[model samples]
Target: MGLTVVAGMLVVVGIDVTAVQLARTQLWDAADSAALDAADRVDEDRVYAEGLHERVPVARAGVAEIAGRHLAEERRPHLVRSWSLGSRTGSPDGESAVVEVVGRVDLPIVGGVAEAFGGGVTVTVVSRARSQVR
Candidate 1:
């Protein structure tokens, strides 16, 4: 009986861990897409005035807005019970777009248990993209 109980618990843990990994991967994909989209959207005014000699310039507000719109419009994974854009979702430099996505994973069995301790399993993914013109 003891062995059976231990085996079952282990199996549950394995499943929950797999779910977390899947959720993290999905979040990462979404963040990457958002970053790429934002990077492609250069400041048109800057480009028109300065011209992109080497790299395109990105505005922090524009990058955040674009990334937020992409994340809001993009399809989310079912494993991610809930998610939100992180504060780091903006351009670190004038030429790059950085996106951070934070999500809570839905565990099949131990979700409640984990939540009771510290709000369940949460995952964060960050992605960056840059555009250059030659």
Candidate 2:
């Protein structure tokens, strides 16, 4: 009986760990896709006229729009907590931007045990793309 109980607990732990890792990986892929999409649509005229400093907000908005679209399509049930965008100026070579999207993933295993913890697992993903001034 004791050995069986231990084995069962171990299995539960393994499942939880796997779920967390999978959730994190999915978030990262979504972020990457969103960042690339936004980077591809960057307005060169705006960046050039306003300069990298002032263009950060514009680029950030682009990224957030793309990221939110993706998240809504893929993870609608998981509420997005925050979405942030950052611009890397004076990179010696050129300008670059980064988009970070964070949200809570309702892990099956965790949700099953929500009475103990009270909530689900939180996952965060950050993706960066270099601005192509063309």
Candidate 3:
């Protein structure tokens, strides 16, 4: 009986950990997709006026808007309780799009009690993509 109880507890813990990891990976995928989408969105006004430089110029506003839209539109994993745009979602060098996505994951077994107490693990992921004139 003791060993059976221990094994069952271990299984529950393993499932919880796996759920959190899966949520993190899904969040990362979202960030990567958002970054890729933002990378292609160059500042058209700057490009038209100054011509294409060695690297495509990515505007901060464009990156933020694209990332935000992607996050809003894309479907997220059920394990993820909620997701929001991180502050670092922008173009750092005017050439690359950096996207940061943040979310909380709820464990399978303990999630109910923890959520009732307003507790959950936070996950954050950052992804970057750049475009070149070539």
Candidate 4:
């Protein structure tokens, strides 16, 4: 009986592990896609300064707005809890958009209890990407 119980527990934990990893991947996907979409619409028709520098023309408002729109569309049904925009900045690093996505993965069987106790593990993922200028 003890061995059977241990095996069953292991199986459950294993499934949880897989679910967690997939959630992480999905979070990354959401970030990447939103960043890409924001970058795409950032600025397609714009002129750059006359200088020897690597700089990107940024459309800050549109970038954040577009990113939020994409996140709203891409939010997963169960895995995602809530998501929001973080910061949109441009510097030597790059003209980037930072998207933060949060989700919860309830533990197998005990998910409800775990959440009730202290809330299930909340995963907050922040993704960043640079925009290109034309």
Candidate lDDT values, in order: 0.87, 0.57, 0.91, 0.63
In the range 18-131, model 4's lDDT, one tens digit per residue, is: 777777788778877877776555343443344323445445566667877887787474654555555432222335665666666555555666776885566667776775
- Candidate 3 clashing pairs? none
lDDT of 3 by residue, 13-51 (tens): 998998899899999999999999999998988899999
Residue 124 of candidate 2: its Cα lDDT? 64
Ten-residue region with minimum lDDT total, candidate 3: 111-120
CA RMSD of all predictions = 1.6, 5.6, 1.6, 3.6
Each prediction's TM-score against the native? 0.90, 0.66, 0.90, 0.71
Question: What's the best-to-worst order under lDDT?
Answer: 3, 1, 4, 2
Per-residue lDDT over 39-125 for candidate 2, one digit per residue giving the tens place of the 0 to 100 score: 655555666777655223234445556655655666433433333332321122224445576656565655667636856766666
Better of 2 and 3 by TM-score: 3
Clash number by candidate, in order:
0, 0, 0, 0
Q: Which pairs clash in the backbone of model 2?
A: none
